[model samples]
Target: MKPQIACVLIFLSVGIALGECDELMKELGRSKTSLGGLANELVELRQIQRRVGRRIRSWEDKARQNEVYLGRLIEQRSISEGWLARFEEINRKLLAGEISSDDKEERIARNIVRIAEFQAKIDRRQATIDFRIGKIEKAQAQADLYRSRFEARESVVADIEEQRDAKKLLVLTLEADLEACKAGMA
Candidate 1:
């Protein structure tokens, strides 16, 4: 009768130990699953960050190009203004009859055509400059938008990192508990 009682007690202890081990295994499994999900989230966030960075770079390049084109347009307008000024001076002289020449009428007609052409060029250049200015404004707006989105995502990434760290710590704790359980069973 004493032997039978000792055997039943041992059997109950083994059953309790097995139950604890099973519970620990389940907990460890849950921790591993949570860690994997966090890692996947981190990867997705990094991809989003890279894409936003690319958009910002593209906007910057477009803005730079617009600036270069605007500069050229300004230079062209300046040259055209100078030519128009010179032509106006010549026309004024011709009208004033400051010089007498056999081909005075022909020279006047030629000067008038040159002045018209210079004025047309100046007008065209001004239009182009206006258009480029609009484009530059649009590029700047796009860049600002990208920057805003990037900053928002960066904050999210930081949060995710913190979550990942916490999950890592949880996993370590779960693993330590599993090791202790195994040692107890041994």
Candidate 2:
């Protein structure tokens, strides 16, 4: 509202004195052209803002999926750890026993091998999960940055709208003054 008043005051300073109708029409033309351009720019900015909003939603969904996947990975790791512990306990019990059958010895050997292989698999999967988590963090940061840009652009669009309204009022005032000046000439 203040901006509208300021615009009117600025244009009023153009002096309502007669004989300047030609200059007034020229200024009015320039103001109209500027207003049109601003309107186009506002439309473009709003479209871009909507696109940004969609992108933000997409990233948020990705983040939620990543969290669920991460939780599953951690749970899987814990279950594997429990299995490894049981394998070690069995190996200890066999070692503490007296002489055993050949089949029992073979069973003990397989148990040790299984433990080592299972631990290696768990380690690999954990590493992969860690890498994925890093990627997720980076993507989230990018989303935050884009959200900030969208908000700033939104503010700019509002300011441009205000300026456009002010320009419109100025143009109307100029047209009225031009008509009055022409009437005075007759």
Candidate 3:
């Protein structure tokens, strides 16, 4: 009777061991699934980061080009001012009677029209410069926004990596436990 009781107890223990092993396997499967999902998310985040980096580089290049254009606009404006100054001096000399001739008067009128045309060009150029500056500022702002998003995604990826590592460790431990249970049963 004692031997029979011992055999029953052994069978009961084996059953419990098998059940525990089955549960561990299920848990390991779930962990592996979770780790796979995390890995996919990390890959997506890396892709986004690369795209954001490219956008930042493109914006920087546009800003540099705008700066060069602005410089050229400034030089043109300076030249226009110089021409206006010379025209003003000519008008002042005419008014002071230091030069008197119909040709001189005609020349003065032509200079006035030329100066007016130059002023209009300067105004238009200034407007264009302002528009370019606004666009550059907008591009810079977009670049900054993209950089922030990239950084945020990087942090999320790091967290996901940590979780994946922990899951991997848990799965390994569960596998070891399942192996031990099988050995015991054998």
Which residue pairs overlap in candidate 3's backbone?
Answer: none
Top candidate by TM-score: 1
| Candidate 3: 10-residue stretch with minimal lDDT | 55-64
Better lDDT candidate (1, 3): 1
Clashing pairs in 1: none
In model 3, where do residues sit more than 4 Å from their true spots?
1-57, 98-102, 154-186
lDDT for each residue of candidate 2 in 1-186, tens digit (9 for 90 to 100) = 999999888777665543388778889999999999999999999999999989766887877788788888888888888989988888887887753545777878999998998899789879978976986897789888988999999999999999999999999999999999999998
lDDT per residue for candidate 1 within 19-64, as digits (tens), equals: 9999999999999999999999999999999999897668888899
> Which structure is stronger by TM-score: 1 or 3?
1
Query: What TM-score does structure 2 among the candidates reach?
Result: 0.49
Reference-based TM-score of each model: 0.52, 0.49, 0.50
Q: In lDDT terms, which candidate is top?
A: 1
The C-alpha stretches of model 1 lying farther than 4 A from their native spots are 1-57, 154-186
Model 2 deviation from native, Cα RMSD in Å: 26.3
Candidate 3 per-residue lDDT, tens place, 3-45, comes to 9999999999999999999999999999999999999999999
